[model samples]
Target: MSEKKNEGNSVSRRSFLRNGALAAAGFMIVPRHVLGRGFVAPSDRLRVAAVGVGGKGYGDITSFAEGRADIAFLCDVDKRRAAKAITTFPKAKFYTDYREMFEKERKNFDAVSVSTPDHQHAVAAMAAMQLGKHVYVQKPLTHDIYEARKLTEAAKKYKVVTQMGNQGASGDGVRQLMEWYNAGLIGDVHTVYVWTDRPVWPQGVAWPQTNATIPAELNWDLWLGTAPKKNFVDNLVPFNWRGWWDYGTGALGDMGCHLIEPPFRVLGLGYPSSVEASVGSVYVGEFNRGYFPESCPPSSHVTMKFPVKGGKEVTMHWMDGGIQPERPEELGPNEMMGDGGNGVIFVGTKGKMMCGTYGINPRLLPTSRNAEVNVPQTIARVPEGHYLQWVNAAIAGYNSKEAKSLSSPFDIAGPLTESILMGNLAIRSYDYREAKIDGKGYNYPGRYIKLLWDGPNMKITNFDPANQFVKRTYREGWSLGV
Candidate 1:
């Protein structure tokens, strides 16, 4: 397939001379590899600049530099968080602000690695793309629907290599799922369920009333890039932001990509036509329902409707905050369903299939069937794992054969992210309310509404107000070029 052309291109001598000319002009210099993608000398490694080089960000850059490339620059809002990366790559220049890093080291690195919070992913990646550098961004792509769409288009417009951090996309499990689907093992998967026990962070709570002092090692303003200005709250940084609307998208955003990718890849699914949701409530004291607009509910269940390749459609159910679907009777009493913490189950006409996070431990219904049934492996696997998939692709350059084979390039990640965020839109819209005409009570106008989606237009057809969530307005100084 043209989409999988990373391994099939033949290079000519003319391209080599052009590479030479670019190098002579002080462009990204590197040695040519025998694979014909780019240079391969040990000393000529692809140079990478990393933003938010801590936590998952640290793991990302470390994987990129794991004997394959040079960690040329490091940037993070909190030095305390990025401590490991700073010491790990002692020679990699460090910066508190990623804007300064890109501006100063524009020509130093051939690629950029972005592991910032969901809100900042787009701006940092776009800056790198604007400078003609390849980028590997973390999953769920962007915080808002418009940002995701913009980045997806930019990948092609700028002709840059791109990969999202949903590592399961590159795993053999999803490939196996695809092969099984191609073999008609799960015929016409009409109903599906994906559940997670996340929100390991706080949710369904009101914002802290007291303002706390900013940590000495953290740049609070830089960390809040694109997010509206807010007073520092204790324990909001490093973690726990997952529950808040401004900096995070709750448990769904944290784990949706991993659990949902199996169905998306296997069934060749696209945008959903409609989505509806019901959220778990946290009661204040014993009677009153707590209202926390800034926080995600403690639990939620979202249902989405999507039309398949045929005229028929499929229904998907997503649950989080320790909730799960009823266990199928096909398995033993003590059998595992989606590895306990997170899992996916596809209910098809013929049979059922399931997997855990990152599409791992895929199995057909009736546990013994995994070994008894065999399907041809039609899809290729990423040999070195997800992080390195981006590394190798970047070294191969934009539009090169290698870049085409990426598992979660923007083209693939964009729609997937949009679909995931659509669930959030439904969840948020579910809470839409108005002051009652009586002036003494409140009314939930959005309750019981199955929001219709116009995917191409990025809007809700029936409810006009819900469109506000589709593309958020950034703060005064923050912009996504939207």
Candidate 2:
């Protein structure tokens, strides 16, 4: 007890700070357990700073807080939207721009969680990663394929722990499906059908005229981030941005991670070899198609081909905007298909299996079989769940002894997200056209050709025009830097 012992033998905050010459000079100040109650071990807790603390952002940041990580800072472009989170973490320093927050609070946080609009995810997450901070980002990993590729590469180079907010990837249900599939329950899955009733917002139309005034509590310019400049429009903030190509990735982007991750994980699926799609269109008053380039089509069905698991090639079908595939024959007349609105189905050589959103309620085809069949539990269940999985992994650090297990780390999630977005590429390219060689009028060329993808190079080999979408042009001030 020669170490200037306090009455209770616990290190006080004042004592810890005064004794922190070691910490100030780069050393472990003290073990958390030895420091006693109310004192989080320097090595135990993750200091987290979150950007976009509203809507889904609120839930994401709160998960880390409740999981025992410290919420050291909060940043958001919309103050009014962020009110709930601000109230929730009153002591957290707040900023309007994530860049400013990162610049100032870089030393204060161990990790960053991003829940901004799709376009903002990569810019914020990559900036934090460049600083060597671990990150947990809301899914579809980035707004474009190029951003996804870069972030994936940076995560390894920076050596930071990472995870995506596709909580279902950490769910027991998907693992159960994997176990069942591995046990030869469903045989080799040759086709997967994932469908959703989304666009819950507007799509398949012209972008709204932007005469409406921007809300005073919202920073319109900062909120625009890497997106092209546009006048503020009502109903576009908070949620409806999902419909716009510049800001959101539409219904497919919104739900694809949850619905598609299982198939990718269970089958060890990688990039697609080809992609094709048919989209629902708005005709207005005439039978002729009304092409609204700015907004996502109301509905779409995209099919992608992937080399099968040591066998034949496989196909994955993605449907959105309330469209769904036909019910399997093994499912009874009364049995609900894929939890009603959203679901996934795998048709294999032996039989079929399926699940609902977030991979909940996984069941084999023929309702009676689910109850009768039991498979060995193989994958470890994440204690606490998805939010805590990253919290624990981050706290464990990249090289921790216990070995943090992140279900959706960027290494896995980045490629999975790229595959999901490839569906969107096909959908967007479907509308591309060229002047007819006959010199009379326009002919839809991309409409007829199947986009042959060279996954390794991230390009469409057959169509040069469709290659433009692999990356996007950022506004003058913003770029996804190395």
RMSDs, each prediction? 7.7, 9.3
Among all windows of 10 consecutive residues in model 2, the one with the lowest summed lDDT is 1-10
Instruction: Give per-residue lDDT, candidate 1, residue 52.
Output: 85
* 1-482 per-residue lDDT for model 1 (tens digits): 00111122322222322333333224634355544655455324678899988899999888887747889899999999989998999999999987666655676778889998888898888767766678999977998888899899989977888999999999998988888878998688999999999989999888999999999999898888777899999988888888998989889988998888889888888999998888887767655576576788899999999998769998999999999999987777889998899999989899998899999999999888998997777788888888887778777677667788889999999999999999888777733455332322234455478899999989899987677788776655555542
lDDT of 1: 0.82
Clashing pairs in 1: 6-401, 31-39, 32-39, 33-38
Q: How many residue pairs clash in each candidate?
A: 4, 1
Once fitted onto the true fold, the runs of candidate 2 whose alpha carbons sit more than 4 angstroms away are 1-39, 401-404, 430-444
Residues 1-482, model 2: lDDT tens digits: 01122235322223323443223224233677798999867768788899989989999988888877988899999999889988999999999988767665666778889999999999888777777788999999998988898899988887788999999998999999999999999887889999999989999777776579888999998899778889898888889999999999999999999999999999999899999988887766544665566789899999999986566788999999899999999999999999999999999999999999988999999978988998878888876899987888777767764235679988899999899888888877733455332322224466567999998899999987877778888766665654
